[model samples]
Target: MRALHIILFLFSFLFSGFFINGQEQLTKHATDSIEELVQKSRKLLADFNIKESLDHTTKVIKYAHEINSNVDISRGHYFMACNYEVIQDFSNSEFHYNEALKYAELAKDSLWIIRSLNGLGNVYSEGYKNLEKGTFYYNKSLEIVEKSNIKTEKLGPILNLGWTYIDEEKYDLAYPYLLEAQKLAQELEEIGRIVAINDIKYLLGRYYAGKNEIEKANQLFNEVIKAVESLEIISVLTDTYKAKSEAFQKVGNTDSAFYSIKKYLFYRDKLLDEEKIKQVEIAKANFSLDDFQRQLDATKKEKEYLAKIARSNMVINIISISLVLLLAGIFFFYRGYQSKKKLSAVLKEKNEELQEAKTEAEKLTNIKSQFISTVSHELRTPLYGVVGITTLLLEEQDIQEKHKKLLNSLKFSGDYLLDLINKVLKISKIESNTEKLTKTPTNLIELSRNLLHSFEYQAKSKSNELILDIQKELPGVLSVDSLKLSEVLINLIGNSTKFTENGKIWLRIKILSLEKDEITIRYEVEDNGVGIPEDKKEFVFEKFSQVGREFNKSEGTGLGLSIVKNLLEMMDSEIHLDSKEGRGTKFHFDLTLEIIDEKGENELNPENSGINQKFRRILVAEDNKINQIVTKNLLDLIGYECTIVENGFNALQMVQKEDFDLILMDLNMPYLNGVEATKRIREFDQTTPIIALTASELSEVKEECMSIGMNDIINKPLDKNDLRNIISKNLLG
Candidate 1:
């Protein structure tokens, strides 16, 4: 009896041990599966597959709940928050992130706790634009990181704090946090540290740009853009472009600003499209989950009915089958409804995107127009001094023959530069749809003669013969946009001059048709030079398109032919190109212009007769010393005495004290600008001819100059002949 009792005890103990081992194995497998799901969720989220990531996290959370594992639950909720945030469902994201934080604290997982805190910060700061709330969460994360001495993990919270301050435009407070993050990233050897460094650099660039330190800001922005592009970090690239655009706009660099904003929009649109795709996928996933739940509930009901009908009749079983089929039909109908709803939402979002893009495009156009005007003024200001000095040197009678030749060359180059600037501005105006044709009675014969005469120095330098061939039947006077016509002819002739050496170039006008009211005339510019290749012919008229740069020694901005094409088009004409490689090129265009009889035309040749040279004193208001010297020398050459003032205030003072025949006021001046001074001067003394001198586009300032009681306006680099003519006309009138 004693031996049998001992054997029973041993059997019972071995059976209990086996049961305990089996239970332990099952628990380990379940935990391993949850861990695997959490890892997959993280990867999918990082790849921007928000729906797939959420699905994986959902599975993880379900398994974690079954096992009652706090760590796994925390991880699942953290990833769920991230996916929600990506979809911009901030309320859900905030709830999930809080849940994650609570579970992480329960699990005593510091890494998850920090991540959850940062996630909350991003939700508040970026999505909601609530900087104060965002900063609080970021600081909480930072506090924990500092206490734990986790250097690798601290970079994120620090960077987040800096970003919050920058968003608030509080760069002074942002700098320290950004600097600390940069230093920490530099010390770390983590794989993600490079990305962290780039983030810090981008924030620092924003800080400097806000301070209006453009050069420094641009340098940092360039660096960040290059690195992020290589890393394929699109989000950072978009933000960087937006910041860069704002920086350029602040400094009135309209071109750069426009370019940056375009890039910003492109990337932003790309992101939007990707996000839309994700949203659709998420919607499908939601429908799938709902379908699964309904099917699961139906299965439970069917099983309960089967058990209940086992003891009942066949009629009850048939009724249960009918109910199951009815539920399945309802599920299909619900799915169809969901799909249509999702499609409608997507279409509405796309329409909104298009409207936004259109508005941005219009804004960019306005920016481009402003940029062109600003650049024209800035460029012409310095060019005025260059051209004026060169002209003055050329007029000196005692200049050596060699120096005279050099001066002529210098003058030619200066003139070429001015033409190039004008061409660029013209292209901008044409593209902006601002250019218009203004017709007046013009002498075609004199206009053609002057156009040829202007290119004489250029033709001589290239050993090219310039020929003017006008049909005898062509009318001498016609109503046309002389400025536009002149520009077109100048560009064509200039293009021929640039390519042809030791060749004959002709500017020809043939009367295609003659009528009582108008005449159709075909104009041609033919040159024997390095003709464009057949493949390049089509591209020759493109802006900034150049050909034969390797062989041709001539240098140009490649805008001549394009300007010709645009101007001709504006005049309701088309430019045709004919060329053979290594032979010659001919460009022709036709225009129908109104005939103006010579009997009705009146001409005034202003006489410098009325002014007494000694008594006619001109007061010149100029801030730049070089410009002042140039203006004074030109006036002296014109045989007039002038008093110079450094600024508009001084000019006002001089005008009040002394008597002057005219005041040459430079529009841009120190202390007081020409416009304000003219306003003040007109308040007291209104009779003196205040000829506004400017290096800006004449049309931009002309009306204001005229409205401010100024009698006339003169564009600068002070053309000797124009200066003499304008001064004589104003003084005589």
Candidate 2:
């Protein structure tokens, strides 16, 4: 989340950078209509309307392009790439960011270019696959801006450098850059820059607070609230409130602290609401509200005609009856008049009803879409807990090879399940046009490693390089989401891997300009297997589109690039392609990211200390030999005694039969699963613990196990650390 903030802040800086320096003439003010769309997109990104946000940003970029407005175009890509970074589509982000840089450079717009470079750095540092290169690009950008005489650009680089230091945990090193940025921000009289200054101050304050420097922290907090007060913009209100809340929290003012958090949420949502209202108004103004009434009036006229026909028909009928005696020999006119009147009345009523139904149906469809997207977001947290725990367990060194393999397999399956769930969620959101996006600080290096671990086998089978050319100078953590952005990379990588019979795939990163925020990340999945034609590039992003090729149809659902396009679009990023009809293929795309301040370069490395840890006697309760062997091996490595029993019933007998520190039970035992066995074990030995092993999808299944006196439940594909961590946190810790 801190990383996510860095990315967002970087974007803000990049955009602001465009406002300063020699490139000031590059359309700071976009056209009203496109700007209106851009505003809606900002709101949508806030609301997690990833699809809608992308749709709007795409329009903004197109319009910017149409007008040849370099600044607006740069801003368009800068904002769009944020969401793409969140969704893990580094390639697309790289493409659009590069395009934005091109525009900035074409106009000789250093400010916008600086922002684009910063953004590119963020993508590599946080969103894409290169961190070392990310830092390099970010530094290069800083150097360029330092000489530009643009205080804003200079301030941005200072802030970014400070963050890189902080991420590296060089607190002393981070302070000076931060101090400089704060001073520059004050000099510029910019509320946005001031808001950022307060954040750095607050973080610094937090460090001081952690060190018990209450006075210094309090002074910083004072400045934070002051900065908040100076910014009237509601968009800044969330941070203002949150900063105050944290400050109050540090001061031990609980009521004020809680109030601050509440206020933060309120203002955060309020800003979005205001944007939505404005969007509604703008959309409304685009069309005359009176037009519906005009349609109603036309319908009314038709109804009046029908009524007049009825009246005439009734008169005709009466006249026909009166004249029936005279015209009985020759009249079918009365019958025809009666039929025409009924037909006209029926047709008018049916048409009106049909239109009403269509309107109602559209509304319901929208509601359903919103509900699904909302629910999917809610589901992510719990899934994270399950997957996270499983992953941590696989890292335990004390575990034996057999159990380790089992844990590894389980982890793979769990990841696969998570992917499936995410795919379903994303597809649902996309189909309904209601996908949500959230940006946070992400670790590009760690994320890329995980991607390799997750898909290496699949790649290896095809004999592909699955290459990553990472940069060294990028911010250690840039604000983005690893999950979504990884999704993009995975899609592109998958596309390359699937198409290439036996070829190498590449993801390349570069910094286009240090003077601007544009950091260009190039993803070229060059495959010796096959290539795409230049003509197909434009239409490839269309939903479910597959370039018309005989080999392509058998490869995939064809939504990979479409989803990629949508993901990038949501982030206010653009995509480009260069592919030949033959000579193999190289696919590439770029985006302009908003370069944010880096506090430090962080190293993510977990500890492994088995010798210091102690394991006691454990009672093994499993109905199957295979599971028992897996458990026993893991237990033995961790230096725990295990008495294996074939069934939960026997485990209970043994538990009542003897004393043990922990009991491992299978959920699907012959006589009873772990739940029942634990319940039985609890009859006399309530103090002894039990853990369940099952392949249940629901984490709530753990609750069921615990409800029956089990200590914890380990789902099938058990990780030793799910065992160790559970033991450690619940028992050892």
Candidate 3:
């Protein structure tokens, strides 16, 4: 049974393509050509063209090396070993078999491992007639089969074991295994089962004859002869005829035994001729190997001759060039020194001017950042009042339907305005190089699906469909900055929604490849929108540049794709754009994420609870009165009462005299700013959560707040949910 398994396994290696783990990295045509060459080699071997077959097989091995395919190379080695075995070259056969085993294990191919084991067993049992070593190899092969529970071709080794015992004259030990092989072979499909059944029957007949059961042994031999006569398996028929002759002679039938002996001798002579032809084939194959080795030696000798000639020419050239180079070196050294003296003064003047320009640029950058931060804070303070008041008003049921609609519209506008402000500040922080990416274990498929579900409403409003295509084999979790990933997806999908109407948008995430601890995935957002013009394709990634299209005539700050580009670049990736006029647009990028353990989920994901969790007392520090009202009311809505102070200085004094569980210290306050006040407060009170509450989007200020012992920072105009979450997390911690 194990022999049958090994034959089929070897058959596959000869006839089919070998698969490398990363076969996708190879071009399809290259893989196909290699497979074709291997199959061709199998045909040549079957036709007894051993020399040509070895040629083709060795070509495959070389090609496999060119492509760096360990599995294919293993298949090549295994086939070459089979070729060597056919030539009666047991030494070379063993060497190639061991080589095959080495690479098969490297390729993690269990079936190939079994094939190598069985082949080695045959070399010991049939070639060297070493029963002990043969039994060891056969047992190891069976262990692999049993462990893997592979039933398709397990009869090969059982049959081999039966034969090994029979050859050693242990008929009793061989009978049980041969019978088992017979039963297993009957379960197989037609032609192969027939061949295997006849082979096993002959072995069982030999065993019966050894036990001196002449009648049973003769009956079994007759049945095997009848089955294999038309099948033309010369070896089986010859063995069966000889065994029947022995049984007849033991039963004292001289004439019948002589007839059977004559038949056996006829087939034996034919088999001998076949063996001679096979030896001739082996000689031709050896000639081919010798020819190839000679060619390699000739090429090596040619290379050595060429090297000798080149070395001889090199001495003459060096002697000719030394004097010229020495004169040239002195002239260049003097000329270079004279030039350096004049260039040094000019370089010094240029360096001073360049330093001044760099300083001026830095100063202007600071000024622009400060102006944006200040304007953002001022706008957020007023917007906070508008949104908070509108939210509180919407909670009242007595309002008329028209007034309610107006209030809803106003609130939507305020929210949109706040989003625009946040985008501007995000761009500022990114340009200033102050934003940091924090990685966590996240299920990207779940994250992508959840993000798509969130946009269902917006997609429906435009009569568009959001489609999600995620690879089923994608790993459950990866270490990444999920917040940034979500933001990038949102921007891309949001852009699709804005420009697309009555169409479909697809968000596709698929695993590209997985190596050891890192998996690369490709994310694509595609939409059948009025695509951007070719001229404006590059322009759209620039900040605040919208493509000139009718569908894109709607209101947008145009910072969405720019922010996506920057964020991806920060993560060491780039966003690719593919668009065609009036067709569609596709934004895709590849990201490689580190694999993380499922148990580390909680370690990577912090709990963010939006439920109201109020403390005993809260402090509100702001210079703006509307901001104070908005902050106090927002806190009160969440079941906390806060004392308002006019500025950081007043808040600092009040904090020393009064007790508060949390402080929402505004960063840009009058008198003493939030950084100073927080520093002073931390000097005495380090236990309370001092959260920096500001509309400024500068990461520098956030870092400064943390440096002064602030626990967290929340950007405004803040959502009620964000405020609740931040407060609960900091206060409870």
Candidate 4:
């Protein structure tokens, strides 16, 4: 009996230990499964598949709860909360965050708790705009991180707090947090530190811009733009460029402003296109996933049915049936594979076609741009002479009244035609995405006053009071696209003056922000005349649009506001309209400029600014008899002793033989082109200035002239002022 009892005890102990080991293995497997699910959820979140992330987290939570693992449950809830926050489901985000925190507290997991707090903070601040509530949670998380040795998660709350303050316009309060975050970000090894630094600079730029330290702001903005552009951070780069444009415009650098604005638009549009493509891909992937799920379900059900049949059937029959099912499965899978391959090929072909179409469209656009540019240049040359000669003739003392009146009409017609041509070219350039900004030093106050003054007579005709309100202590000289700025201002002021009758028209300019070398300016053209109707306001900016067709018969091409809108767009600005019927309209916009320490030479006085008094000979090259006469007459008027040449060959021959001060070589000539002539002349007479007279506004022509050793270039149909200025700049220098 003692031997039996000992044996029984041994057996029981062996059985119990085996059972316990098996249970332990099963529990480990379950835990591993939960972890795998959590990892998958994390990957889904990383890919921004929030719905899938939520579903995976939900499964993870269910599995964790079944296993009674508090830590894993907390992780599952945390992931769920993050997904909810991403989807902007604030209520669910808050609930899951609280649940995560509860489980984390139960598990005594500090990291999970900190994450939950941070998530809650994000939900309140970014989603609900509850800054105080968000700050409280962030502070709690920060406190926890400080107590712990973990530095990886430290910057999150700090950055969040800083951005929150920035959005609230509390720059003073934002800086401390941003600075701290910037310092902490450098110590982080896992994330890219250089990108982090640039991001910090981006925020700092905005802060300084808000503080009216435009120069400092621009420096920071530029740094960010340089780094982020190379990094291809499209969203951030777009915002940075836009901010930089605004900063430049403030200081009156409309050229830089337009350049920056174009960059911003390019990146912005690229981002949008990328997002659209991603959405399409996602839709396709989702459809494929659904199809795969259905196929998997069908295969599983087929397998289950086969297994049941195999269990009950004879051996030979079971084998035969199994073989048939295997063959069927193979056939179906092969068919499916072939279908997928065909679909892929079709998609590829379609993509290729799309690429070809895009290429063709871009080619067409370039052609259109070039055609318009060439035509505009050609037209401007003759128009310049017509307007200039007509004006000069009108000023003659011995002319009859009727002749003078007719001359005035001819001048008016020429001016109107020139305006029409310019407007068309501007519109074409914009449409073809070929407009380029040229920067030069400009006086903002003087430019504004000149624009306002130009419209004074027109205002008086309507018995309107023109008021100029400019901010005091504003910077005078700024680098800007003077032409575009003038165009925008003229359009806005002209529209206001024309519309307002027997009322007040105010041209107001104020400083939006100022940095050391950069500034943002706000301009307002307000009128209390025949106000735009609420319904008609939207149409005012449309091309060929007129405001209130029934009330007014204004003799305009209706391109003023339309041109203003386009010009402002080029300058990275937008027009804001506020108007009421019978009351008035206020058109507001903003521009950025870069302040210049010294004025540019282009700021010439029209009356006395000319070449130094010297009896110098000039050679005029031309292919047309009419242009030769016109050129000679204009040169005579300016007291320049000029010798006329019929073409580029004669001009080149004359320059090589005679000691001429300057040569105006025509580009399109009979034998040798101006470019070749200039090249040939440079071989022998390199000292004399060879100015190419071309009827092409395209910069390529200018580049061609420069490459062939030409000293300067003058466009035809040129203004007398432009000609004189060019002459003084090149010859006098």
Candidate 5:
């Protein structure tokens, strides 16, 4: 039932030999001696001989410090922390865990550091009931495990996190973690990790019981009890019975609860017999007394050593005074010259190494960028066909109602996948410093109104009221990155709508300061919804972090707020949040922008103005068959006749053979790419419009498309409206 307690025993047995193996560089005899002490200490601890274990661990620490072995020192302190935790001395457990962490970091041992962090987490979570601090340490441990790809070491932190969430009665939050732990436990079971298997089974039983799934919970509990009984894991047996009793009580099964409680009491008493209890008490008293005596003895020895050093230094200094006078400036100059020459040579060598490293790093970065671009194109190509087909199907008027519902769901999923892909690529670009701000003339009030309009369907679905408030004194237009600003607002507003139901959400814009050339405007998105907890505020902006995942599990991929933070920072602004639980949340930020034109045009334009229905011939150049079908169908929907070509080379031939109003050229095509084909076409026909259709990132190809005489570019997994608008605008020009 308690993962921390169960994992503590496993940690001892698994890591007992870690320090011994790490000290292989020492003398064989010394290593053998230390190894024996470590093994004996662990055995005594396992056997419940607390005093004997402490004595052996103390000796190990002394020997380790004398030999200056940080690995051994950390091991000793970690074991001491475990023993204290077993005895419920959380203060001492916390102190020793910290000390162990310090030495583990000094030794550069990641495994020991993770162990120390988990130990501290257990002290806070299990002993003190401080879930916040406990969750922090557990997350830290998991972060290290993930970064290091230590598959074998990830189960502890994951189990502990699930256990903590269950303690908070947030069963929804605990479910995913417990399921992941169950998967990991099964993997470990393949390698014969019996303890982990039983621990996960027990924790999962508790989770099911908490969720009122009594039958499933009882089945899991029965299996765990059978396994732990066979293994003679008395502590686990006691904890399981206690949890089963509480679960039965929750369901008002008084007779079963009573039976379970009796079993729990029996096991608890068996695990801690009266004689064992007396011995543990006596051990605690003796440990305190011995600690005091050891401190006194150490103080005496330190004073005596310092006195000896003082006398030795006094005699050495008197001799050094005479020696210095005899040696004079020649020795000093020679030593200084040699030292500078060695230092300069070392610096030069280091600089050469740094240059080589920089070159290798740049090479790797380029490789990563190329890989991402290739993957994006490959994924988007297929996704475009799916999304396009789904859209076309949904537009059919004679479809069955049930099938229409299914199609809508399919469309939602396709759109979600496309959004996830775009966000991921956006993150990659930002992290690589390839994302740049393009400051364009923008209407502030109109942009805010349009962003709110975009979320109307979502808001209505949630039964939430959407409000936009803009100060009259604000300028009509400002020089800003409207694309990035829209992205940030869309994410924020979308989150508010997703988390709030039958509540009011507001997008407020205020002029903080107005100047002749620049104005500082504050933008706020506030919602009366389920707000974030205080402990989770700092992590809201972390990548892939979902604060209210338990409330809305399927809504987001947890990248929105992280993208918002990065984009705002790029624009030289910061986002701030204020919220309380069960009330509301508000996110605000301020940006100072240059006034482009005070009386800028703020006209609202319809997305799809009907284009002329004149007989116009269009050329479609694409390599994929599915894309060709989807594209041709789309153009057909818009009442345009299209000629299809298998590649850019074929498109060039077709264009030369006949006159066409526009050409939709796929960027990556066989025989000839869009860029090359566009160049060839420009040499002959300069009047016809050529539009680049790419599955690659638009930023990567936009400039090249323009340079190659392409009029515009559209990303794949494209929206139908975007396709229509681009085609219409290009044809008009």
Candidate 6:
């Protein structure tokens, strides 16, 4: 059954188109305009618009050696990394920082490499919030500072580390670094640094105050005020006053507390105003980029207009090229035809050859499936141990709080491993021609949110931007399984995020039409990533399909997008791609939004509305103790009644003697498993629902369940939600 699910889910890939279909003119001016955009970015960098400068640096690096500029190449990567850090894109910043470091090493510039490493460390610390790695870089930067005494240059890393410690709430640990940073700031006569140092001092006072060292805390705060007065960095002077007020208020001075609140607001407003100006500049830079791209597109259009004759000649040349290829294909076809004629005379020989190959392939496939099934089950056992033991370990009285966190991480990793194994099994099933989807009316809004949260971590890792426009305005839920739709979106979003760095992706919803009886919702995932080539667009969404190797290679069974296509088609929806070679890509699809009557909705989602009034008690007949434990846990979570019976005969005896609401009879039990027991029970009672729970991949199981008057069918690995949903639908209907 699982294998069938995978195969059906991947079948659409075999039928999807294999080439780009949009009609557009390719022009020369667009080419030149793209060039000018690159050139202009170099000038912007030189003009001190450093962020804008960094944004276009990669375009120049694309032609680094051809343009004969090693210095630019090294500087470009370094500068781009610095900009990425500003926008909180730690991964890309680290990646580019490493690139810059490599180029700097090739250029034999220890100074630049040191700078790049420092930048890398800073990004790790602030952007990714990785203090340990940040400390490593700061210590290295401190080494350089100690040797050269580069005045204010070394203070950045030291201060960053000190703040990191402050975040950890370790005042005693932070003091030494803060004091050293303060000394350096004073020696350099930097007013901004001096003010920041005072702020840390005030933080120390607060920390000590909380420790009940009242006098010590007051003394520290007094010294911080004096230090701030000495530095006279007016921008932070108001904050100093506010801190002083808080210190006084802490000593039961209400008047001072009110004064501090006012002082804080004054400084906060000033800081916000300054930040607003910087943000405006950033907005302008982004606007300029968009405007410039449009201009480039226009230039390409003009070039096409000018090169009309050249384009005609190019078309003729392409036709000639096609003719040559066609002739070559004909030659091969003739030879193949002659071979087929010979094969016709010895058809039995050919059939035998095919038979031998097919048998060998089937044997290999069976062995592969067996190997995967065994390994996956083995791995699952350990993961379950980890999850269970970790759960128990977390409850220990002697476990340190910090160690508790480490245990949580361990459990999360275990679950992650189990998840990966399941994904591999799913992909293997799809590849082996065994997959299917349960057709149903699924609410897509809820589904989209689930997938979004799931892939939030993926987008975060790439520093990729995601925009969602799905809203409740979308009517009529779609005819699809929410879980399957979520899986499809996860696959698409994961791909988009991976292929693009520091770019935006959008999952938008548009209602094409809405009526009382029907609604159509368009769901599209768009990304500013490496787009498909004109000739290879549709080929990308096929089974085992992957794009250009040179375009940021990814490793996975290339079945994700293909599975999405299959699942969507089964639900009677279409997925599309709109893109150019270098611009980006957008995926579009529409789903039939289902609208159920108000009363029907309540009946369909009984448990969801907390309106299940049917029998809550259920009897589960299972042979495996592990399965029993899992079943009990699921039942407890959902607030249900469950009693476990080891064998079918025991379950039958229990049912014969007592009234049971529902019997979750498991097949392959020790004595007279599900089907036979169900038959015996049905002879006496016809009203009670019997749900078959099994691990078999037999088609006859569903038929057998129905023949014995069983309410529904579900296969195992212990699905809790499916159990609840099935039971609800059965009782409600």
Q: What TM-score, over all chains together, does every model reach?
A: 0.52, 0.35, 0.49, 0.55, 0.55, 0.42
Candidate 3 minimal-lDDT segment of 10 residues: 17-26
Question: What lDDT score belongs to each candidate, Candidate 1 first?
Answer: 0.77, 0.61, 0.74, 0.72, 0.77, 0.62
The predicted structure with the larger lDDT, 5 or 6, is: 5
Candidate 6 lDDT, 249-287, residue by residue in tens? 557654554455445545534543454323322423122
Cα displacement (angstroms), candidate 4, residue 619, comes to: 2.5
Q: Could you tell which candidate, 3 or 6, scores higher by TM-score?
A: 3
The residue-by-residue lDDT of candidate 4 on 471-496, one tens digit each, is: 88788788888878888878778787
lDDT by residue for model 3 (412-490), tens: 8998898798788778878767678878788887788879998897888899999999889888889999988988998
Residue 76 in candidate 1 has what lDDT? 77
Off by over 4 Å in 6: 1-344, 351-411, 428-433, 450-468, 471-473, 481-483, 493-506, 512-521, 527-559, 565-586, 590-599, 603-616, 666-668, 690-733
TM-score for candidate 4: 0.55
- The reply for model 3, stretches above 4 Å from the true place, is 1-359, 440-457, 468-477, 549-552, 603-617, 639-643, 648-661
lDDT string, candidate 2, 1-733, tens digits: 3434554454454345534344345435578887688668866765444556766776777677667687788777876776565444566667777877887777676776787787687677655446577777777778667766555666665666666655555567677777777677675445356557666776676556555576687677667666666654454455556656556666667566556655665665465357432332222211222433543564454334333334534444334323332342122233333433543464356557657766886788778766654565445435544555555566577888888888777766666665555555566566565555656666666776666556677778887767776677554555564556777878877777766756777665554544344354544445665677777777777655677555545455567787777777776665666677665566565544545455664443223434334447677766555555666766665556678888877877777767777766767678666677777667777676566665443323545776787766655445554566665443442
**Against the true structure, candidate 4 has what lDDT?**
0.72
Clashes of each: 0, 90, 10, 25, 0, 17
Off by over 4 Å in 4: 1-335, 381-385, 453-467, 502-505, 548-554, 599-603, 609-614, 690-692, 698-700, 706-714
